[model samples]
Target: MIKNHLSQVFYCFIITIILVFNSCKDKINSENQTKTEQTEVSKTVYASSVIPFFDQWKLILGDGSNAGIATEFENKDFFYTQNDGKDNWVVFKSPNGGDTHGTSNNTRTELAQTKKWYPKTANDKLSATLKVMNVSATGDATVAASHSVVVGQIHSADAFENEPLKIFYKKYPGHTKGSVFWHYEINTAGDDNAKRWDYSSAVWGNDFSVVGSDVSTFPEEPKEGIELGEEFSYQVVVKDGIMNLTFTSPNHETKTFTKNLLLSEYTTKSDIPEQTKKLFFPIGQDGVERSEAYAGEGCFFKLGCYNQTNGKSPEVNKNWCSGAETHGGDIQKQYADGNYAEVWFKTGSISVSDTAVSNDGYFAKND
Candidate 1:
């Protein structure tokens, strides 16, 4: 009787162990299924869909890859969106170095408006509300990394090889405030742009040329400066052959500047202003200008985080080519090492000719 009872208890113990094992296995499988479902559902929304003005814009990441104009898209390593407690914002990101387009050595994850228009059009407008997030911190304080990201631009589509406008936000390593500035690329009085340089204007802080005496030194922060994640808005209007630019923020003054894009303003070296002379003194870039600059050139607009940092030797040009860190194409390594630039756009809108056409064959193109 005792042996029989022991046998019965042993069998019961084995049965209970099998039941527990099966229960745990089922739970693990269930959790994996749920996680898979959540991932699938989250992919339904994308940058082009959630962000406004996406219909007129397409994305190109730092690696020079993109999904053809589509509403559903996401690049894991570059362009995407994230919520910041208050709201969701489209995020543009790029490594310090990666595959690039054109003659530019810098890499960016930015948006290009598919539409093309002349700067002389009756009225072409582009506007956006954005904030700077991060720039590569590994570059020389005087170089482009100092201004890690360019939020917007007016790029020439023809042979001019010109970016008439580039809006920039720059910050120092330990400073509490960054700067808001814009650059004016020379339309160069003639086709010989070999000697041209951008003329920067301060919107709320020191212009791009305000560098420290040495790489380790830093200039005084602007009396009225901008900080990372501080929201701001800008509007670019090209009407009557002139470009009107406006920058605004809640704490900063509303600043405006009007430039004639169709005509050449710098026709000669003497035409350069005193401020420009002082600013560009180091580079010795002062050169003669052509008579007809950027006239009759096709122009378009671009928006996103265009990184200004590179791995080039700082000894070559500490101001523009500081030896910033680059992790090759290892994106995960780059991000972990903080070798990337990031920008955020909360709102945006675009306007072209009423002709309903753009560079891409959309309604405006057919019209």
Candidate 2:
């Protein structure tokens, strides 16, 4: 009887052990399956994706008489020109005293035109390449000065009423020597009239003196001389009231700049009744005049835009004050507007070998 009881006990113990081991095996298998499924899903979602946006436009500026009658137009098909005859005239986006002579009729003209085309989606990103070719210029050259290329909004009257983002480059005989200069002016039409904030050589000069009651409320200028070039890729991204500007070189080196101004800042104070919401890209301070003194010769350039948005995102509000708030969203909208973001090319008797555009990029939106 005792032997029989011991056998029964042994068998029961073995059975219990077997059951526990099988249960554990099942649990392990289930866990592994779940992990594998998750990995597959992640791979499926993150595969390379294509985002569509408008590509850059090719523009031509020519002298009317010798280049003949150059007719420039911008539409869905292409941004182009037909030259008449004269080839001695130089093309300019920003003309200074000496360089003005080369411009037809000594008047700054828009060689291309664009219509408004907003994206259907919000929070999208866009990018493009700006190629500035040195066409030709004439006469007495001095120190080559830098040229300014800008990307901003244009108001109803075609006036550069709003503060547009700008990039400045210096032109020398053989070397390109210039840095990006980013400037912002708040309450521009009010008691703060023309009170500007610059993040360029201003830091080097340490001068914040400007016309405004709250000139005392200015922030210290950030670092300047961030270099950019042909081999470098420049990109801007905007989402949910944030603006991120990035520059990547061929070697994969990247530098980023960011700023967050609030939407309320876009509003005008009761003191400035003339202020209105407008977007603009005026030739920056470093046009042909400055280049003549700095660059040994002059330069000519072109502007382009890439639009990538489906409109599912939020529409850009002109009243939004802070580009930081909209993330990269505002910059994306500017590109989608079908306008060539303003950029200056150099041509003439000067050399702008080392001129570079600034990385002062931004986005704007509310909430």
The number of the candidate with the highest lDDT is 1
For residues 223-271, write the lDDT of model 1, one tens digit per residue: 7999888999999998867889999999889999988887777877788
Q: What is the TM-score of each candidate against the true structure?
A: 0.85, 0.33
RMSD of each: 4.3, 24.6
Cα-lDDT of candidate 2: 0.26
lDDT of 2 by residue, 140-165 (tens): 11111112233221111111123222
TM-score of structure candidate 2: 0.33
Supply the global lDDT for candidate 1. Answer: 0.76
> Worst lDDT window (10 residues) for model 2?
358-367
User: Residue 53 error for model 2, in Å?
Assistant: 6.4
